[model samples]
Target: MKIALIGYGKMGQAIEAIALQRGHEVVLKVSIDNLEDNTIENIRKADVAIEFTGPESAYENILRCIEAGVPVVSGSTGWLDKYEAAKASCTAHNSAMLYASNFSVGVNIFFALNQKLAALMQPHPEYDVKMLEIHHTQKKDAPSGTAITLAEQILEQNKQKTKWVNHDGSNASDLVILSERIDPAPGTHVITYTSAIDDIEIRHTAHNRQGFATGAVLAAEFLQNKKGIFSMSDVLGI
Candidate 1:
């Protein structure tokens, strides 16, 4: 498989290394310095494009790939407001797109576990749920997307949480998601169900980017020749 890296940051480089290790080739690499080279023609050279760009550029980058007849797998977050538009574009072009807030296989599994736990705790409404996610200081978006996904899963199952707030919710129906930025921390997400009696917590700590990188490559492999929108669940069949 030929992969085009839409963001050449730490995650992008990590994906490239993993893709290569899996016998895939990195054909095109686009970074902030090389924005001009992100043209559709250049992006179309690869079998699939793996985008890990920021909110400001992720939407446009994915559109460029779709327009150029390239299948795209994006792990970018914070720009979900435009996700529907991207999906519509993919369908119109008869192309393929796969997106995941965090592509780590462990993280995706953690997502399922979180939902299951939330359902189990629904009958026992005494437990107040809260989340904390810590990432490297360089991470731009607060309340990391993985944290948001976790919070969303909890809100769906736990009736007590109607919404999620970054720090504190206005009332009990809000799920609090606390975010911390500390250097050298790749990522750490913790979901705790706290009550007067005891605390039950589930945590996923990333020692490095390899898990995410590997999962992205695996998604790319699964995305070949596929059309329409997909998620990590589709690739991993979770």
Candidate 2:
């Protein structure tokens, strides 16, 4: 399949390597250096588009893919407030789009585990839950998108948590999501449930970008000819 990489940063380059290894071609590579090439006419050349830009450009990039009638797999974060709008545009244009916070298969499975554990811990209000996520210093979004996804899953299952806070939460109903930026760290997330008796923790760590890149390519492959919105759960069938 022909793929267009909407963000040619480290993640985009990694995706390109994985796509090529999987017998796919990357037709377009858009980055800060070449914003002029990210046009509807240029986007239409690819069967699918993989978007890994920052939140500032994710919405517009996703919309352009829809307008071009090309399927899109977006792994951007910090712009989910406009997700509904993007889905509406896809529906109106009959375009296909897949979005995921963390495309690593392991992370998705950890997501599933997180939900189950949250459900199991719902009745035990004594155990207060908090999260810690560490990423590379260059990552723009604090608390990371994967951390948000995990927090959301916990919120859905645990009624005690009504919202998530980026730091040590002051409110009892808030889920604390502490973030740290360290060099050489791709990603790391830990969900901890603490009580007077014991502590329970589940974590997911990434050694490199290959796992996420592979999943993005897989998602692009799945969305090549389909329509409507989808998540990583759809691609991994989890």
TM-score of 2: 0.99
- Summing lDDT over every window of 10 consecutive residues in candidate 1, give the lowest-scoring window: 161-170
Highest TM-score: give the candidate number.
Answer: 2
lDDT of 2 by residue, 1-238 (tens): 9999999999999999999999999899999999999999999999999999998999999999999999999999999999999999999999999999999999999999999999999999999999999999999998899999999999998888889999885899999999999999999999999999999999999999999999999999999899999999998889
How accurate locally is residue 107 in candidate 1, as Cα lDDT from 0 to 100?
98
TM-score of each: 0.98, 0.99
**Which ten residues in a row are the worst by lDDT in model 2?**
161-170
Q: Write the per-residue lDDT of candidate 1 for residues 1-238, one digit (tens) a residue.
A: 8999999999999999999888999999999989999999999899999999999999999999999999999999999999999999999999999999999999999999998998899999999989999999999998899999998888888887788999865688889999999989999999999999999999999999999999999999999888989999999899
TM-score of 1: 0.98
